[model samples]
Target: MRPPLAAVLGIDVGLLQSGMGGVAGAELACAVSNAGAAGCAGGYKLVGAPLSAMLDRLGTGTDRPVGINLIPEVVGAEELDHQLTQVLDETPPHVYVSLFGMPDDKVFDRVADAGRHLVVQVGTVEDGVRAAGLGAVVVAQGIEAGGHLLGTARRDELVAALRAELPDACIAASGGIGSPEEAARAVAAGADGVLLGTAFVVAHESRAHERFKALVTAAGESDTVITDVYEIGWPGRRHRVLATAVTADPDQPKKFIGKTVVEGKPYLVPRFSAAVPTEATTGRIEEMALYCGLSCSAIPAETSAADVVAGFAGVLPGSPAVTN
Candidate 1:
């Protein structure tokens, strides 16, 4: 049976996972909650007092349920978890969604101890089943998602299989979801909710670099390619982004990139890919990491987060239900 991911978060079957990257600051998370939606922060990498500060702002911003995306495999996880636990103990987020690697139930138990929920993002049916088996109430199946694909399953096929296997778990569909129709389709396809990242990245409230926003707006319907060619932060997983200089430009020299350790630290960052531009059409746009989904073409315009939510607020099943 599907786990009680939705009920734990205290929301309806229909929901939205705030798509905040490089911009999931406290303000936006609270803004999402204030706008009749949920705010999620994937801040496992955030460190020092700044992490506490960010969580403090999020707590003070709104009374809505908030979540953080945690990848257990990242170095210094223990410290990060400690900080997260401290913040959750004080501010008490609504949930904690984890990915990138498997998290033992011991972690889930810790989240539950905070009186919070636990949601896990998965890419395949096998992973989903394992998540449910491990006591994760929420299952986020990401397909064509912007930042991290979860790299597991085909969106439609996996959704159907997961539904049949974990009927009781709260299933949320993510990846390449940019329109009301897609959101509705997720629900009709057995997903209890929808998670959008790229669509929100261009929102008025989003802090995404102006140059990046412009590129997302300017990208043709068919733009977006997933490549791990020059990755630094998370190795092994190539991300999808607009054709940028860091990735595109055939004549550009292949700069060095790989996992490394500096000053007792472990992580790789080559000079060439590290200096990518953040602006949209600076022409250097093609040289930076601008994660986006293939569905970006359907985004009507660069608008406010509230307006984007409102656009799909009334959307419902249009086409007759098709058996999965």
Candidate 2:
């Protein structure tokens, strides 16, 4: 009685971890996958050597099926094509690609042609149907999700709508889902599985900044806000983040507030940049964009990714309770 997505992805449970940039790295993804759930590494604008190295690490880290998240809006067509090509060529057949926004038909065709699985996270029923029509496992993302939002629908509503439209499609719910009870609610609303971002942000293996983890663990239900203020790198997309001083008044001075290193390269993080604070970041970390979701209330402290996966495994349909 396992969820359809679990069977499709060859995992024991239907739970999937978000490919949170800066936070979800090889360690976190491997930990989650090892715990009988699906895990995905964030591929935020990564290309060339960095992307290749990441895929190599993931391939060697765990034999379990893992995913690489790529956003279509972040990179141009040429770079995205390169990323997809590298992913399909360099990784084994078990590795799949997950996209944040609706990709063109060519992207879908490329993955199908390569015989690799593709998962698309969409924010609307129409997008879900389209993705499903193109032979992708659909992940319906609500506005409550962290990072860049896809649409303005609520988690349950979108899940139900997608289910009604595509009865046989593998639909996973994302956003505002932290606790096992909340995951159950999503299932009750017709989701075959649940995808979590905020809960994984506080995982012990996450690469998020220590202060950022602490702030998320201490956040309340009402401490999150959806804003488009931090849009320097990836613009025009709204994201849910913790209520910070910068968010309170977004008109602050446009100066470099921090620095982060990704794949051996260093980049200066300017004020209102969409970069999340990672362990490699140094500067006014407090003023940077701290992406968080309403599910922060369920993240009490940093724990192992296995425990986070175990907590949600039991809530999935027909999945046995997993122990960390």
Predicted structure with the largest lDDT when compared to the true one: 2
Instruction: Give the alpha-carbon lDDT of every model.
Output: 0.61, 0.88
Candidate 2 lDDT for residue 237: 92
Model 2 regions lying over 4 Å from their true place: 1-3, 321-324
Off by over 4 Å in 1: 1-8, 93-101, 249-285, 316-324
- What would you estimate as the lDDT of candidate 2? 0.88
Can you write out model 1's per-residue Cα lDDT over 1-324, one digit (the tens) per residue? 333233446642245555343455566666666665566664656665656666677677777676666666554458657765656765655544444445665776676676666667777777788877776754455557766566556676677788899877767777777888887777777776666777877877776667677788777545787777545556666567776555565355655433332213344335234222322113334465677776688775688866765665554222112212
Clashes of each: 15, 0
Please give the lDDT score at residue 166 for candidate 2: 86
For candidate 2, write residues 25-86 as lDDT tens digits. 87888888999888999998888999898989988888998989998888977788999989
TM-score against native, each model: 0.82, 0.97
Evaluate model 1: give its TM-score: 0.82
The C-alpha RMSD of each candidate to the native structure, in angstroms, is 5.5, 2.1
